[model samples]
Target: MSEQPVPVTTLLDDEAFLGTYQPDIWVFVQRSLIIGFLTAVVFGPLIGLPPEYWLPIMGFTTVFSAFIFDDYTSWLNHRADVWHLTSLRLIYENGNAPEQNAAVNLADIHATQRKLYKNLRLDLETGQSVLMKYLTNPRAIERDIDIARLALMGTIADEADIPTAEEANS
Candidate 1:
């Protein structure tokens, strides 16, 4: 059978030598945008009316807040960091934004777990992990780690070959 093509992963931060992938906050941005537009429609016109149009005024303010808040949040999320796994190791870097980074050897990794929710979190045996709740592409990130884990296991097939010098002495 022919081997399938491997997908390409990208870096996401610079502040950290290595960083984990995070999901985008697009959903949050979209929701905020909708609320802003709704408020404008309901109150923008009434703001010019009598002082008794306080309801409209409040709506207008809400819309304005949503627009400003969502815009900034989305803008920031666009700069989220990313995590990647190669055949030999895991890498954390800035996808488009700058953040601290680090790299952990796959041989040292003990386990990896993916937590799915409003945000995705990756727990690694390396004791170092990242929490990216607002990242845009979480599935891809998890997939990368899973691939790495598989590759790692393949490299150390025999229990005698597993790295245990440090732990055994301790």
Candidate 2:
């Protein structure tokens, strides 16, 4: 039996789907660890537990809180924080809230900058900026965004003008 290809889903009318960007799994893991550690530190001392039990209590609390926080963050925050790149625009959807969703036209993007710590910053022509956090391989994503922006602005005249992945790497 032959395997069939999955269909690409586009978010916008008349726009081709380029890619989808989500926060890296490591980001969630780090967040969960930090929050869990802080929680254990803050509450472990208040319970009036004996010195001998403090280590075990704190360890259990850290693990429990980390697991719960990881699940909650993954479901509520990480899943909703997505960037859908269409041929024409960058669509951002925040959680389950429709009012928080936004779309930025590729043509209006002045430049894309890869900031410190997995953040991609989009500077707009209007002097405004949008920051996307915890993106995996943000440098490559920045390049992809630039290529899309150039294509939308009619700067790329031919397919040959666009660099291949190998060429880009070199």
Candidate 3:
């Protein structure tokens, strides 16, 4: 329930660093550029544009637009989209307003399903599910969530409950 500054990495309302849930920002940027490149290759000539000139332009536009969109959404979700967890709760904000947030008590989490590419779907006791998608490190997030669960239940986590030191440091 107390705020902590994580230097260059994170800023949250009042949450200590349990863990974070975010995708690599570059991944979305790269995907957008790739889509633009493919579009230029497939559609540029049909629109009477030369591939050589069109490719870069299209790609640049795609990446730029993607960056803008991503930035805006990231900005919106800064409070929530990328979770900054604490011992007692997972706090997230997803909009321009102060009231726009979704905080889940660690105790309400019933189960979680994780997929490759860093997607985690958490089932809550309320029968609602929350999906934290495109995380850069799903397993680490899961580990921390598990730890939070134990902590919320008034249990202490042993070394075996967390990621190895090497993995966590990285």
Candidate 4:
């Protein structure tokens, strides 16, 4: 007889996993480009190098700026930060440390707002707000949060009770 593989379960197995969100890649690219360009423009001439060597100096400064600002600093700070949406709660994890994690019950979220271009603010009933930065399509995430919140509160209609597109048209 062939041996059967056992099913693996995790601590979160009881909750339905909805989505996982991380900082947008475009935020990194944009920051790197802006910082690199500004560093090259400002420091290239300040070095008082020969014209022939100025191009190489600028290139080096730009690369160094990108490495220092984006790769080393920003990436180290935000790379491990992630938000997970589940049926019961929203979980935030920072870095690889288990102690640096938090979860808020969906019922506790009073509202969600999209701030600037990519930031999401979650206002809790207790008057505390959590900010999620550099998310891609934060508007969609906001909508999803609203939907989940309403569903949890038993406000959404059943799918069977809703009319299909064709039925509505007819």
Candidates 2 and 3: which is better by lDDT? 2
Write one digit per residue (lDDT tens) for candidate 4, span 18-133: 77777866776665566656666676678765566655665676678767545656656676677878777888877656576888899999978788657789999999999887
Off by over 4 Å in 2: 1-13, 28-79, 158-170
Residue 15 lDDT (model 4) = 80
What 10-residue stretch in candidate 2 is worst by lDDT? 1-10
lDDT of 1 by residue, 15-52 (tens): 21223444445655554556655665666565565545
Colliding pairs, model 3: 79-93, 80-92, 80-93
Q: For candidate 2, give the lDDT of residue 51.
A: 61
lDDT of 3 by residue, 1-170 (tens): 33533323334576466665555555555556666777677778888876578867776768666675574365335333546678777766543553655688889998666764457788899999987765656777777787777767866667465545455558
Query: What lDDT does candidate 1 reach at residue 129?
Result: 64
Candidate 4: 10-residue stretch with minimal lDDT: 1-10
CA lDDT, every model vs. true structure: 0.52, 0.71, 0.65, 0.71
Reference-based lDDT, residue 115, model 2: 77
| Runs in model 3 lying further than 4 Å from the true structure | 1-17, 29-80, 95-97, 155-157, 161-170
Judge candidate 3 at residue 112 and give its lDDT. 65
Tens-digit per-residue lDDT, 23-84, candidate 2: 77676556556655666666667876556665666567657765754655543565557787
Descending-TM-score candidate ranking: 4, 2, 3, 1
The local lDDT score (0 to 100) that residue 58 gets in candidate 3 is 78
lDDT of 1: 0.52
